[model samples]
Target: MWVFSWMSWRNSLKPPDSLVRKLNRLRRQERPPKREQGAKMGKRPRYHLQGTAFTGIWLLALGFLLFLSPPPDTGRCAPPPTPTAELVVRAKFPAGKPQPPPVTSTAAILVDAQSGDILFSHNATTRLPIASTTKIMTALVALEKLDLNKQVTVSARAVSTIGSKSGLEQGESLTVEQLLYALLVVSGNDAAIALAEAAAGSVEAFVAEMNKRAESLGLTDTHFANPSGVNNTKHFSSARDLAVLARTALQNPTFASIVSTRDFALPPLADGTKREFHNHNVLLGELAWVNGVKTGSTPYAKYCVVVSGSTEGVSLIAVVLGAAEDETRWKEARALLEYGLSLRPRTLLCDRGQLITQLDIGDPLGRQVNVVTDRALVARLSADQVATGTIFWEREARFPIRAGEVLGRLEFTCAGRSLGSARLLAAQSVETPNIDLLLEFWRRGWAPAFLTGRK
Candidate 1:
């Protein structure tokens, strides 16, 4: 059997065309051996077949076929993957997420910094005294109402602030920018008072302004008592409200810069002594990703912090109010942020079907469709932005929209930023738009301007 197989293999081998051509060329220009030159001079050369050379050529061709021929079952695009079907109606997910990885804060919430999507919430609306975290609003109000380079005289009232002083002297002067650095970086109660007084002419007015701003922001569960978050019954905010405040406040480029700074030095007073400020948000150096908003604590408020973090393009904000300890707030913030962002691109916001509010047809036969996306879409959105989006359907899709015809487009946006869009395809073909033989070419092709007017 082995001998038969070897014979079959040898017989199957054909002489390589390239080697045959080379031998034919050699025969036309035959060069004899030195001794045979004299004997065969001027005569046609004999054609000699070399068995060893033929074997080598045949083996080379066999090798090429064995190595170069690809397997018969190769594919065009590697079997086209598992066909990632877009999450349609079934993909709709709720933004009101449950507990996140054992958070330690009493009332905490996580949200997308831009979209305001509430990823997780626990007692988020429960109004509780937020300590120095109140400065976040203070910074916002000042950034909006006060000039950053304007000088503010530190008053005796500011010098007397109780908790977390920025060491301001009664007669000292500083720019609004300098005071903001102290206010946010050190959680300076004194700086907060100075900023409030400077922005509104008095602390009372500033607190009122803060409350008004809260109301304008649609924060139903928030109020402000003082610029510095002293434990006043009136000075309280919910975790959800704080998250909203953080998002709003961070939108100001000046306020965002002040909060995110890890360290800053105050402008020298008359004595030329520079006061160094360090951010109370320890999560900065401790964790690579954590960025600032504020950290607050008092005997009444325990510990509170508003933190934002990001890895890649996905970012998150965590508001933890009333933690047992400062470290607990930081840990809880980190957990909430990580948990929210880990489910990053997996979040499917909405699709064309949910966005189609209504449809109008202009044909004689009124037609409608269960609008769906022609190309299925997977959108990333925060919980808050999901409730609000723009759906633009044509005012009138004149006659004959076939099945799968795009009627309109739905764009998912958050905070004025577009996430993505999907085509609103007609679910079924309308009967009136069906092949109407009565319609003229002029109507179908559109009227020529010269025929209609003096073009």
Candidate 2:
């Protein structure tokens, strides 16, 4: 059976007739002397025909196998991901209520700093990335828990942190106050890390404290996964929550001063080189009215800011998040601040002891007494409210007025609702004229006859 199989395989490799004839012709052309020498030496001569047949068979087999198989895939390269554009969220207003200025931000809010009243908002309670603005809470927590003058040594982990840095070198020593400036003014991620480790002995524990502080401040939509506000799924805050945080932070004098600083210089380092940091908040000097808070940005969070400003006794905190561009956040924040100011415009209606009007004590002689407000009256009214507002006088007592005596009240009312009021006081003493003479003069219903004739 083995011999039969070998014969069959040899038969399968047999060359065609044309190849066989070419081989025969080549053998005939070869010199007889070489064949005789090979025979005499008892050596087996090599045949070109056999080698060519074996190689051609192998090549044909390979070509057949290749033809039967599917082609290998050489995949095209995929394009890199483009950054996502900021979301467009519009605030909804009730019928007849004033709307905030149009802004392009994922979430935004405007609040009255003094009253904590939310003036305007858009998706204000949705949790989203906050970026370096997380330092606001960091500074606040540090101010409360860590001593400003305490010295802290920088760590390797802090020095290796990514994002905005304040030239912090590993093993460098710095005061808490200096790091606070670096954290807020320059949004230094390294400074944030160093402060976190110093405060809680670890980044994890410091983040826990941050969340705890957020919970205490009623920031339900806020969560802190890290001290530096690096891009993390668990690190996020809402516009409303951030505005609330900023308002709380501003209450701390140290925190308030740090965030408002435009430029700060740290003491010389070991190499005798001074490090200077410029605040990332553009609203500080460009808009003279803008006083505080923070600026933040990342690919995920886009650009965000918390802006505080006071104009005409109306203090407002405006937060804009997820703006498409860095400048967009500043522009949107400014618009929100200005719009909030316009919503609740404050006007000085009257100053203490300022004359409001003159009243006639006697009709015939018409002796005038200065009617003044006993206290300053400032009216805070919205656009619609101001449109429906009116001022009126109410008398509480009849005259024979004494200086500084409350004679009446000046009430400011809008839409039948009293906004504010001040007591009307007599600016000077005014004695009553004789009763009989006053009655006779009133009965005449005219100035004295001599004064009328002269006029």
Candidate 3:
């Protein structure tokens, strides 16, 4: 049986023809009956028990090994850690020495006209009766509103009014320009009325306009009830607001010239009389750079003066109200002017087209470009303070850029505090080679490419 089993296995292992022929012949020839005494024992399919057991044992050992090992680090389920805080502290100022007491006055202010810097003040914002100083603003408004050459007929009301006058006759006709000189230099109250009447048709209307102008100039602490600054409870202004008015008046070059004149001649009157007037402002003749401003005095409003001058390229305006005496006001103004001239002006750090920084471009030959300003940089500062600062380049850009394009910014700082910044512009334009052109130039010689260029 073992031999037969071996032969069957070998025959099955041969080819399909050998196994098929043997199976067909056995089916056709075999007819032996099973003996009842010896029941045929059915053949049991042989099983590879050892191999199955070996596979089961190996799988069990692998499962135990995997259970003892750490889990795979997937890294997907972890939460983020908290961030740490960074603390910063600022510098503290040291205690400074005590400054001397400011000069006493009923009203006073020391102002830098260009910067609108108020260096000192005492009762500067308090409203006080302003006498002929009102004429300053009145003259300024007239000059701004009326044509200098326009003719004005002196009316009975102008000539009949009862105050300081240029001896104007009712029948006389004069140009507005002549009247302005008389009004300013002589403090002619009649001229003020005539100017108001000519400019606004009436004193009341002109005073209303004056108040309107004061409001527009942010002079909240002032009010005007009359054109001549005649004594009235409503006609009042503070030293600070008057300083603002003075600055505004100086903005008009015509007004400045008019105010600065010590003496000026008026056009001939109808009777062939020429009016000569002297300025009440004493500083104009006494000080070298002092120009014409205005002065005022009344029982209610003591000696007052608005003095302005330029020295060493610096302009200053000093306002003194209610001085103890006429000459003291001038003296105080001179001191203030001298003090202002003594201060050292700040220096400008940059100028137009000045190079501020460099930018890198990807070009092989010219790898960087300069960034510059389109205009001059300037700042007003005291002489003692350091004006050092740094230029910061924009991080997102690379350059080879066109002129006038904004490239970066310059930040000005002092004592770790930012002052201001100016924009940086490209100094010039730049161009780059295209990829195809670069590749062609790399592949071929320069002479050949130049000689046979594409149209």
Strongest candidate by TM-score: 2
Best-to-worst TM-score order: 2, 1, 3
What do the candidate models score in CA lDDT, each in turn? Answer: 0.71, 0.75, 0.69
Residue 202 lDDT, candidate 2, scale 0-100:
93
Model 1 clash number: 3
What are the per-residue Cα lDDT tens digits for candidate 3 across 1-455?
Answer: 65565445334432236434744554444434465886876543223333344335434433443333222221121231232211122222235532323555588887878778887778899999888889878988798789999888888887777656777777667788888877877888888888999999998999988998899899988899888877899889999999999999889887887888788776666668877778888888889888767888887788888889865335788888888788788888888777665553434656778776566654433335677876655544454445554555554343225777776666665445454667878777754433333334433543223223533
Error of 1 at 432 (Å): 55
Ranking by lDDT: 2, 1, 3
Ten-residue segment with the worst summed lDDT in candidate 2? 69-78
By TM-score, the better pick of 1 and 2 is 2
Q: Estimate each model's TM-score.
A: 0.57, 0.60, 0.55
TM-score for candidate 1, residues paired by index: 0.57
Q: What tens digits encode model 1's per-residue C-alpha lDDT throughout 334-447? A: 888778865553455554455353355533233345667655445444333342334566434544457777766666554455656777677877543211221222233443
Would you give me the overall lDDT of model 2?
A: 0.75
Provide the RMSD of all predictions against the true structure, rounded to 1 decimal. Answer: 22.2, 46.8, 24.2
Q: Could you tell me how far off, in angstroms, the CA of residue 29 lies in candidate 1 after the best superposition?
A: 17
Give per-residue lDDT, candidate 1, residue 396.
47
